[model samples]
Each structure stands twice: as C-alpha cells, then as structure tokens.
Target: MTISVNGEKKVFEKAQMSVRELLDALEYKVGFAVALNTTFVLNTTYETTMIKDGDALDILAPVQGG
Candidate 1:
C-alpha cells in the first residue's frame, strides 16, 4: 500500500495497517500528534485506527522556542 506521510509518499508491504503499527514501522516514539486524511486522530485510538492505501498521514511534533 502507498500512503503519504507528512507530504512524502511511502510504500508499505502490507495492504493495511493501524496507526500504531505504522508509527512503529517508521521508528516513531512518543511526543507527536497525527492527522489522518485531514482529520485529527486521537492518541487513544492509534492502535485501532486502520490506515489504507492512498491515505494521507501528517505527523507533527511539538516545537519549543524562546
């Protein structure tokens, strides 16, 4: 399956994957927020949220500035 992550196209070997699984596959740890297909995804539902082909995922990390 092909999905756009943070505006970049990424191809996966599976037909579908959960948000949590995708994060793990990409080696992403805690401290980030995700929006799927322009909708915000709850952190509690990451393990249950299924991601399919052509889906768009935006992962954002908090930034601190002086």
Candidate 2:
C-alpha cells in the first residue's frame, strides 16, 4: 500500500502496520509526536494503533533551548 510520510510518498509491503512498526522502520525519534491522517497518535497507544493506506503522517520532534 502507498502512504505519505512527512509529505513524502512511501510504499509498504503490507496494508496495515502499527505505529510502533512504522516508527521502527522509519527510525524516527521516540519523543516525536506523530500525526496520522491528521490525527494525533499518543505515544502509549502507538503499539496498538493501526496505520492504513493513503495515510498522511507527520512526525515532529521537540527541540530544547540552547
């Protein structure tokens, strides 16, 4: 299936993947906030949440002050 990650298109081998799997595969930082299909995905619920095709995801990380 095809999906968009941070505005870039990506094709996955399977149609469904949990948020944990997605983060692991994409190598995004664990502290980042993830928005899937315009909805925020809680860090605690990533392991149980499922991602589908054509989903638009935005992974944002916090930056500390200097």
Candidate 3:
C-alpha cells in the first residue's frame, strides 16, 4: 500500500496497517499528533485506526524553544 507520510511518499508491503503499527515502523517514541487525511486521530484510537492506500498521514511533534 502507498501512503504519504509527512509529505513523503512511502509504500508498505501490507494492504493495511494500524496507526500504532505505522508509528512503530517510523520508530516514534515520544508524544505526537497524528492526522489522517486532515482528520485528527486520538492516541487511544491508534490501535484501531487503519491506514489505507492514498491516505495522507501527518505526524507532528511538539518543539521547545528557549
């Protein structure tokens, strides 16, 4: 399956994947927000949210400045 991650194109071998799986694949360990096709995905829903082809996922992390 092909999807866009943070504006970059990425293809996965599987036809579908959960949000949690995607995060793990990306090695995301810290707090962040996930938006699928402009829709916000709750952290609690990560395990249930399924990603499909042509989907756009935006992973955003908070930044701190001095």
Candidate 4:
C-alpha cells in the first residue's frame, strides 16, 4: 500500500496496517500525535486504527518554545 507520511510518500508491502504497526515499522518514538486523513486519531486507538492505501498519516510531536 502507498500512503503519505508527514508529506512524503511511502510504500509498504502489506495491503493494510494499523497505526501502531506503521509507527513501529518506521521506528517512531512515543509522545507523538497522529492524524489519519486529516482527522485526529486518539493514542488509545492507534492499535485499532487501520490505515489503507492513499491515506495520509501525520505524526506530530510537541515542541518546547519560549
């Protein structure tokens, strides 16, 4: 499947994958927010949120600014 992650296109061999799986495959650390196709996905639901082809996934992390 092909998906856009943080503005970049990524192709995967699997037909479908959960948000958690994708994060693990990409080696993402904790404490990040996720958006699937422009909608926010709760952290608790990551394991159940399935991602498909042509989907857009955004990984946002908090920043410390003064």
Total clashing pairs in model 4: 0
Question: What are the Cα lDDT values of the candidates?
Answer: 0.99, 0.89, 0.96, 0.97
Tell me the deviation in Å of residue 3 in model 2: 0.6
User: Candidate 1 on 1-66: residue-level lDDT in tens?
Assistant: 999999999999999999999999999999999999999999999999999999999999999999
- Tens-digit lDDT track for model 4 on 1-66? 999999999999999999999999999979889999999999899999999999999999999999
Ranking by lDDT: 1, 4, 3, 2
Query: Which runs in model 3 stand beyond 4 Å of their true positions?
Result: none
Per-residue CA lDDT of model 3 for 1-66, tens digit only, reads 999999999999999999999999989987899999999999999999999999999999988999
Give the per-residue Cα lDDT of candidate 4 at 8. 100
Model 4 lDDT, residue 50, Cα: 100
Model 1, TM vs. native: 0.95
Candidate 4's C-alpha runs over 4 A off are: none
Instruction: Compute the lDDT for candidate 2.
Output: 0.89
Superposition-based RMSD of candidate 2 using all C-alpha atoms, in angstroms: 1.7
Point out the higher-scoring one by TM-score: 2 or 4.
Answer: 4
TM match of model 3 to true structure: 0.93
Name the better of 1 and 2 by lDDT.
1
Comparison by lDDT, 1 against 3, better one:
1
